[model samples]
Target: MCSLAADLATLFVAFALANLLVIGKFVGEPAKPHGLVMFAMIAPVYALLAIQAGVYGIRSLAAVRETILRACWAFAQAVMLMLVIVYFGKIAEQLSRLTFVVGVGFSLCGLILLRPVMARLIPRMIGEMPAIAVVIVDSVPFTAPTGTVLLDARVLGIDPVRHDAEMAARLASAVGHAERVIVACPSERINDWSIALKSLEARGEILVPELMRFAPAKLDEYDHHPTLVVAGGPLQYRDRIIKRLFDVLVAGIATLLLSPVLLLTALAVKLTSPGPILFRQQRLGRDARLFSIYKFRTMRSDMTDHAAAQLTQRSDPRVTRVGAFLRRTSIDELPQILNVLKGDMSIVGPRPHAPAARAADKLYWEVDDRYWERHCIKPGITGLAQVRGHRGATNAHQDLIDRLQSDLEYVTNWSVWRDLRIVFATLRVLVHDKAY
Candidate 1:
């Protein structure tokens, strides 16, 4: 995604440079014709390159490698096409090849260089972007102290504590001067937190938990205290039922539609390798229920058990040539549609890990309690994690954490539109080698 942004920025810079040169030549009494005409001629080619490269709609941070490759490919293709048009149209003499080459080269280099510099400088930039006032309260001084340590550096403006009524009044005054106010405090002191929360809540203030420090487990540990008995129950049975129904409907339809591809994949697996057409393995499902998930066999039958659980790195000995291709394009996962049809999976949810994959188990369990909450929904053939480039391997602890976060985000913001968006995103990733 950053690469795509770089490509667009490069294109914009190229157009801007061309326009500036043209304007200087024309308006400053030089030899050039209309400035606007030159600007129009260059801008359309840049826009075309951006569109072909899929740069315009890229998110700020996602699959960087694929985005860069796509940008480079699109730029190369655009340059070649532009050169052909200019040469054949008898305008080659009018356009300076040195100037064109320098413009393109400089623009690409500038775009590629700007992203890392901007990323490094973003913390400093946020202060200049927008400002918000935040107040923190806690019964334990250490708890509030920890809050300051965990505070987001991106947030700007004042932070006033509950201990000072004078600062609290100043905070109130600053609230109107600021764009927004955030309150972070311990869930244990509900009455005290509530009195403060209610006053803020009454004033239409937004409240967010300092989840990084005092997680749900810590909050639940203090829930029994008399002062912290704020009321809220688990998810309603009706809502759970509705979610299950939707999952079944979507998974069922997907299985039926993709049956042909699944069949062809099975045949290909059987023909290319001397092994079971489908690889079935035990995986922890919803609520830690054990279920067998299916996939087209991509590895040889002689692949070691340890290697099966471990990640298949690039150019691994176990992966057959066909297996490598299948893995790269994710055709190996097509058989999981059967699991979805059998009610063992959903069309979109958390990607299930093999029960024997101890590496995955250790990393996933290290996170906040809500890490396991992903199991509350059925496992999926394609999930937010898979779409976001979190699938295939568990080399880093952060990867598992990111996957769990995406899974939880999908659950919290569950909607038909969100599900469709996830499906489209998954398709976009699948069309290219975003994952292994």
Candidate 2:
């Protein structure tokens, strides 16, 4: 929020400076450009780009060099977008060439200046926020306070191969009490600890050797240690509102347009199957919340309730004739539009899994511990993995891993435009034969 406000302020400053450069002084009554609407539209896109670049992330953990680099990257991206908008929007005539150049230069300079200002203002506004304790596993010297706790790597007893009850409890207690946690260790061990602490609430950070080599491309540096925040989910307050609005608009329109097909599918299922027209199952959603997801019934009624509880093979006998066609054409998924409207799902995201969803005759969560990370965002009707042809029964361990990678990528790098792209890709694949 603060970064966005700063960007808006800097935009005005750039406008004033541009006026100064063009008219030799601020005009008493400035002429409104015909392209002012284009400028207004481009401003918010710039802010989203800035946020994605980590402009508004935890400032305490970011080094000065990293902060400046993000600012430059975000500014450059916003400027390029502005250029495209001006050319396509046919608003280039309103902006003098000199004013455009000066405006771009001034905005970049303003953003660079705004960073240090924000870094200082953010701390003061919070007013003595709680400080979390730090623990170091390695012998390497760090810049933490003089009395920070230093523990041996083996003390945490983090075993990737198996669980140690006592070690787990000990490590949990240490991090549970702190407002945040910093674990300094070798790069290889960071992954093990991260997976163990995946479900923890406290904001966790890993202290690595160098400040610039952190994963997520958005880590912060505190006292010379680059820290990747592992716990808190990324969608911020305003961003959430924006995403919900997008879901409402798209889902509402789709539900109206697809009502005929939905009705026809329901009729076909009722006639061809003895059970309910819709199959309702509990699936995990954002933050591990449970929600009932609805889809067209795709299995015969006489089969036990758990018939499709496992993966459906290529030509499963349990599948009714109508169900097979519905699944192949993805018509069975049309009812999930209602789920999107109800806020249980999104138009695009990581696809939700049933509570007992299975692959290779085993539960999905059992296949990989990292699978739980897919619950970080609202499950979507169509997702990055599904559209990329990773949908269907996971017969191989590598299949789930590949899908998980795509899901996590969508979570860490989410944007409204990206969601729209996924939606379009899904439409392109509606006729494809991969879903069944």
Q: What does candidate 1's lDDT look like per residue over 1-436, in tens digits?
A: 2333445556666645654564444332234333333334554565555554554321322444554555556566767777787778887666544446656666667655654555445546544432333333333332332222223311433232232223223333333322223344444543333333221211213233343354553333221221222212122333333445566677678777877877787778788889788777777665445678877677787883432457667677877777777788888887777787677887777787664453444534443334445654567888887788876676766667777788877765666566678888888788445334
Flag regions of model 1 displaced more than 4 Å: 1-235, 304-308, 358-363, 367-370, 432-435
The most accurate candidate by TM-score is: 2
lDDT at position 48, candidate 2: 68
In the predicted model 1, the residue pairs found to clash are none
* Each prediction's RMSD to truth: 19.4, 9.3
The lDDT of model 1 is: 0.54
Per-residue lDDT value at 309 in model 2: 70
lDDT of 2: 0.70
Model 2 regions more than 4 Å off? 1-193, 196-228, 304-308
lDDT by residue for model 2 over 241-286, one digit each (tens)?
5687689889999988988988888999998769899888777665
Q: What lDDT is reached at residue 230 by model 2?
A: 62
lDDT (Cα atoms) of all candidates against the true structure: 0.54, 0.70
Q: Tell me the deviation in Å of residue 245 in model 2.
A: 1.6
